[model samples]
Target: MLRGQRLGCLSIRKGGSVDTHVEAVLAELAALEDPRMRQVNERHGDDHGVNLTKLRGVAKARGTDHDLALRLWATDDTAARLVAILISRPKSFEASELDSMIREARAVKVHDWLVNYVVKKGPHAEELRVAWLDDPDPVVASAGWALTADVVAKRPELVDLPGLLRTIDAEMKAAPDREQWEMNSTLAAIGIHHPALRPQAIEIGERLEVLKDYPTPPGCTSPFAPIWIGEIVRRQSAG
Candidate 1:
């Protein structure tokens, strides 16, 4: 029983076993925290210190529990939300709920996991994608572009490729960092996936020069769109 404990609007029950369950899960997450891990994750703008491998282990133990997921999410703790995303039934959440969640997820890993593991698998993905694309907030808009980039990679027929390139060409250089990263991804995807559009994609990437000099560790691909596009295309052809 969590007694008087309250997480956001959720009232922790006085004597109920459900509160105990949430308490236990949170305790487990707390136990996994490491300062070293937090420092590494902090570099990427994620707030939690729990090792992801251990966090996923916790989720596997809990399995899918939408009710628990909601409770965990209401806690607004980054590690708990990661577990919530893992155990959530993606299609069960309303579009508005997901919209709110994304906006509230300030931590980078929480935002990324919520988008990739929950929202992307939900029925409202395309709806949210459209709604979020033009959002005034650049971070929210970045998620929109992330979804758009996914579509460009896997379902190219559904998007206006030239329009996307035009947007990237005109706006990417001035776009905020988060939004520009995903926009660059979309540009790379267009070049890699569509042979006919490859030339234009490469040209746009070269012209924009976004992330052109990004420092990438050896053995990993660069995020620079022109180089990323070329390397991926070369790999595909070689394969």
Candidate 2:
């Protein structure tokens, strides 16, 4: 558990013989304290959870070492490196690792890649969708949900977009203070693009009351409120 300063390393519970894996890693690191190790570790710091590419080979040589690298990626800054790993070595990360990657990716490009790859012809679309909704960053979650809506609209038979919409709705309801502007914006875009989810999007907009308290971000006007008011006015006049 990560509390204050000391990070608990991964351990195994086998017959009460507990092992502090990180201590063993430190021992190995002490032995390989050469400039060559430093250079390699730095080169591939983003991967293999270390600064050197030499560590990659070394980690690969030992199962325990590989687990240590994964442990580093499990719950911290090294988690960001999982994005790089997914891009380069798609098959490297396990399910938990992908979830960790989603949690750590705060950039738009990271969401873009994850959305695109997960929706492709693969066996992990459901996992990807779950990751999208569960992501800590609202922007990433919104992008993921929007992508799901888009893919569902395009190929309705493959996945259930409506169900995911309900999921989004449920999340919004559950987290009253969750500011999901980016996710809402993405969903609005999806609504504009997909006919099926437009009505649902409008309903969601109504539920959200976007115009009631929409904050105009600095240097930017409100996107949804104006469009929402205009659409309502148009319909009223036509009626």
TM-score of each: 0.93, 0.41
Please count the clashing residue pairs in each candidate, in the order shown. 0, 6
lDDT of 2: 0.49
Compose the digit string of candidate 1's lDDT tens values, residues 1-239: 00122235464453554597688889999999999999999999898899999999999999999998998898888999999999999999888788888888889889888889998898988888888888888998989999999889787777888998888899999999988998898889888988899999999888878999999999999999889989998998899
Q: In angstroms, how far off is 239's CA in candidate 2?
A: 29
Residue-level lDDT for 157 in candidate 1: 71
After superposition, the stretches of candidate 1 with alpha carbons farther than 4 Å from their true spots are: 1-9, 12-18
**Candidate 1 backbone clash number:** 0
Supply the TM-score for candidate 1: 0.93
In model 2, the worst 10-residue window by lDDT is 1-10
lDDT of each: 0.87, 0.49
Q: Alpha carbon lDDT of residue 7, candidate 2?
A: 26
Over 122-204, each residue of candidate 2 has an lDDT whose tens digit, in order, gives 45555666556555656546645655655654655556556656765666544422235444544455465556667787777
